[model samples]
Target: MSDKLTPEKRSWNMSRIKGMDTKIEVEVRKYLFSKGYRFRKNDKRYPGKPDIVLPKYHVAIFVHGCFWHRHEGCKDATTPKTRTEFWLEKFDKNVKNDQIKQEKLKEMGWKVIVIWECELKKDFQRIMDRLEQEFKK
Candidate 1:
C-alpha cells in the first residue's frame, strides 16, 4: 500500500524513531535483571554499542527490531512497498553493519546474542532460556 502520509509527515514520523532504550530492549533488560544478571547498557567500549553487556560473562546482547535489523524469516520483517529501492538499500546496509559488528564483537572475545522484537512477543521465555544456556557456556 502507498504511504498515507506526505513526504514531510513521513520524515517527521521516521525521525521520531529511537535508536536505543526501545520497548523490547527494556523488556529484555527487566527479565535479565530479575534473573540476577548484572549488565551495562550500550557500553561505548563495545562494537555495535550492545543493548546489554555482561562483563562477567563476556557477552553482548542486542535487541533488534525485526524490520530495522531484517530478522531473517521473521513475520515482522516486511519490506516497505512504498520505496522498494530505498528500503532495500537501507536494509542491506543495516544487515551488513550488523554482521560487521557481530564479527568484531566475536573477534574481541565476546559472545554475541541477538534477540528479535518478534521473539519478545511470542515465546519470550525461550529467549530467556537460551540466554541462560549462553550464560552457562
Candidate 2:
C-alpha cells in the first residue's frame, strides 16, 4: 500500500471518474439512438438523475459501472486493494441509495431499468434487445 500518487495526479485521475457519460454509457446511448429511441440524458428532475430518460414510456435507464455499483460476482467489481473498509462502506451506501431511488421512482409511476457495466460488456446484443423490449412495452 506504499504506492504514492502526487496530489495533482491523484486529483486528475479522480476527476476523470464521472458519475455518468462513461464508455458504456456512450455505447448504450449510441445503440439506442441508432435504433430510433430518444431519451433525455441525466434528467435533473429524476431522483437519481437517470442516465437515460424516456418520458414517453415513463422509463428511466441507469447504467452503473461494476465497481461503483458493486455488481456481485463481477470481476470488474473487485473492492479496492487499498482502503478496503472505506470502499466497502461506500459501495454499500451506493447500493442502498440505488434501492431508495428505485423505490421512489416506482412510487412515482416510473419504470426503472438498470444495466450493469459487466452485462453490457458480456452481452451487448442481449442488453440492447432487452432495452428494445422494455422500450416497446
Best by TM-score: 1
Off by over 4 Å in 2: 4-8
lDDT of 1 by residue, 1-137 (tens): 78999999999999999999998899899999998999999999998899999999999999999999999898889998887999999999999999999999999999999988998799999889988899999
TM-score, one value per model: 0.94, 0.90
Would you list the C-alpha lDDT of every candidate in the order shown?
0.93, 0.90
Q: Candidate 2 has which clashing residue pairs, if any?
A: none
How many residue pairs in model 1 have overlapping backbones?
0
Candidate 2 on 64-133: residue-level lDDT in tens?
9988888888898887677789989999999999999988999999999999998998899998998889
Q: How displaced is residue 66 in candidate 2, in Å?
A: 0.4
| lDDT minimum window of 10 residues, candidate 1 | 74-83
lDDT of 2: 0.90
